[model samples]
Target: MPEYITLTIDGARIRVIEGTSVLDAALDHGICIPHLCHMRGVPDIGVCRLCLVEVVENGRSKITTSCTLGAKEGMVIRAHTEKILKLRRNVAELLVAEAPNSRAIQDIAVRCGVTEVRYPFHHANCVLCGRCVRVCSEVWQSKVLGFVGRGKDRHVALPFNERPEYCKRCWSCIDVCPMTITPCDGPMKEGEEYLCGKCASQLTMIENSPDSCVWCRLGEGFQCSRWRP
Candidate 1:
C-alpha cells in the first residue's frame, strides 16, 4: 500500500497518496479546481496555467501548477483566491484570443468570466503545452510527431511537414490535444478514415464461429457480435 499524506484544500482536510498531485487530491476530495490541458490518465503538461494555486509553507507563498505539484504533509494550499482567480481569467482570455474557433477555449473563457481579449490577435493558437507531442512520443512510443518550429512559431507535426512511415495513426495525439489542432491523420479505410483518436478501423480475424462481430468481441459496442458471418 502506498503511503498517504494529509493536506488541506480550501479549508477541507483531505488524505491522498504520496505521489498524487494536488489536482488529483482535490478532485478525490470533491474539490473543483478550474483547469485545462490536465486530462486523466495523461501526463501533466501544466501549460494552461489555469490550475495555479497559492501554496504556503512556513509562511512562504508561491503560485504553482496543481496538476504537477504533489501533495505533501504540512503544506498549506489555497486553491481559490482573488489573485489566483484574476490570473486564471487573464490566462483564459489570452488563450481564447489565440484560438478563437476552439469551442473548448470559448467555454473556458466564459467560465473564467472573460468577455474579451485585450491582446492583439496573432492567431498562433498552439499554446506550446506539448500534450500532443508527449502523448505521441511518450505514451504511444511513436516518435512521428514533434515540434517543427521554435518559440512563437512552435508547432507539433511530422518532420519537414511530411508524414513519417513510423506513425501508427493511433490518434493518441488527438486524444490528448487541448486545442482544436490535430497533428496527424490516421490510416484511410472504406472512404472513412479514422480522423481522431476515438475512432479507428483495423482488421480482426476470428478462428472459431463466434456469434458476434470480431470487433464486438472486446465488448466495446462498436459492432454487434451477432453480425459475424
Candidate 2:
C-alpha cells in the first residue's frame, strides 16, 4: 500500500502518495504546471525553471521548482501566483530566445505569455533541458549520451563525439529532444530566428483557467507528461 500525504495547492486540498513531487501531484489532479526536462518515469533534475512555484513557509514564500519539491503533509504550494507567472514567463522567454527553432519551446513560451524575447537570440540547438541525456541514461539505460564541457560550452554528445558500439540505438534521445520539431513557420535562418507565436490562439482557454488542464497541445511536440498514458 502507498502512503499518502495531504497538501494544499492554490487553495485546493489534495492527497497524494508519499514521495511524489509536487509537480506530479498537481499534473495528476489536472493542475497545469509548465515544465520541461521532466519525464514521467525519469528522475526530475529541474533543468527548466518553468515549473517554479511558491512554497509558503511561516509568513514568507520561497520559490522553487515543483518537479524537485516533494509533497508533504500540510504543505502549501502556490503555482500560479503573479510572482511565479512573471518569473515563469521570463524563463520561457529565455528558452525561446535560446532556441527559437523548436516548436515545443515556442509553444511553451506562448503558454507562459511571452509576447517578446528581450534577450538576444543565441539560436543554439539545445537548451540543456537534459531530456535527451536523462532519458538516454535513465530510461533506456544505455548511457550512450551525456553532457560534456562546462558553462557556455556545455552540450550533449556521444562519448568522444562517436557512437559507442554498445549503444541500444533506441533513438529515444532524438524523440525526446525539443529541437526535433521545427517551428510552425519552419526552421529559421541563423540571423533570422524569431519567436513563433502561431499557437497563441490556444491560449484563450488556458488564460481563463490558468491552473486547470485544458488538454493544450503546447506540450505535444516534446511529449509532455500529461500526454503519457
Candidate 3:
C-alpha cells in the first residue's frame, strides 16, 4: 500500500508520498532551494550540503540536509529562514573560492546571497559532489571511479587515475553536472574539449576530427546543436 505524510514548509501545508525527501517535497510544491548537487536519477548523497533546512521535531529544531531527510507526518520545516540563508551563503562563499573560474558557481553564489568570498581562489576543477563517483558505481555498475584520500586532500579518481581498459567511456557525470552546463564562455582551444550547454555547443574536437563528437566522458552527455567557434 502507498503511504503519505503531511508536513509544513514555510507554513505551507504539504502532503508527500512516503520516502519523499524534504528537498524534493519543497521542489514539488514550488519552493526553490539553491543547490548544486541534486540531480534526477542520482542517489542523494547530501555531500553538497546546500539544500539544508531547519526542521522542528518533537519541540526541538535542528538544521538538516533536506535531500537526505525524509518528510514525516506532523513535521514542521522551513526551507529558507534567516539562519538557513546565512548558512547557505557561507557554503556558497567557500565554493566560489574553490571554483572561482566557473560561471555557474559565480551565478549560484549570487543566488545564495553570497556577495563576497573570504577564501582565496583556488581555480579548482572538481567540487567533489560525488555524482561521477555515484553514477559510476550505482548507475553504470562500473566501480571504476572512487574517492581517494580524506579531508582537504580527498578527490574522485579512477584506480591509479589511469584510464582502465574496462572503462565503457560513458560521460553520464557531465550531464548531471550544473557546472558544465554553462562552461567556458571565454574562449575555445583547438585539440581541446568543451562542454557548453548554455551556448548550445557540446564538443570534444581533436585537431584531426572536426565533425565527430563520438567520444565523451559522458556519452550523449549534454543536449545541444549549436557548435560555437
Candidates in descending lDDT order: 2, 3, 1
Pairs with backbone N, CA or C atoms under 3 Å apart (clashes), candidate 1: 212-225, 212-226, 213-225
lDDT of 2 at 111: 87
lDDT of 2 by residue, 1-229 (tens): 9999999999999899987999999999989999888888799999889999999999899999999999999999999999999999999999988988898999899888889989998879999999988888898788988989999999999999999997898888999988999987789998898877877668888878888878898856687788889
For each candidate, the alpha-carbon lDDT, in order, equals 0.63, 0.89, 0.67
Q: Which candidate tops lDDT?
A: 2
| Top of the candidates by TM-score | 2
**Between which residue pairs do clashes occur in model 2?**
none
In candidate 1, what are the lDDT values of residues 76-160, reduced to their tens digit? 8897778887898898888765655444555445545565667655445566767778778777888888878677667777887
Stretches > 4 Å off in candidate 1? 181-229
Task: Output the worst ten-in-a-row residue range by lDDT, candidate 2.
Answer: 219-228
TM-score of 2: 0.97
Better of 1 and 2 by TM-score: 2
Candidate 3, 40-124: lDDT as tens digits: 4568889888888999887889998988888888889877788898999888888777765455665556556565667766756
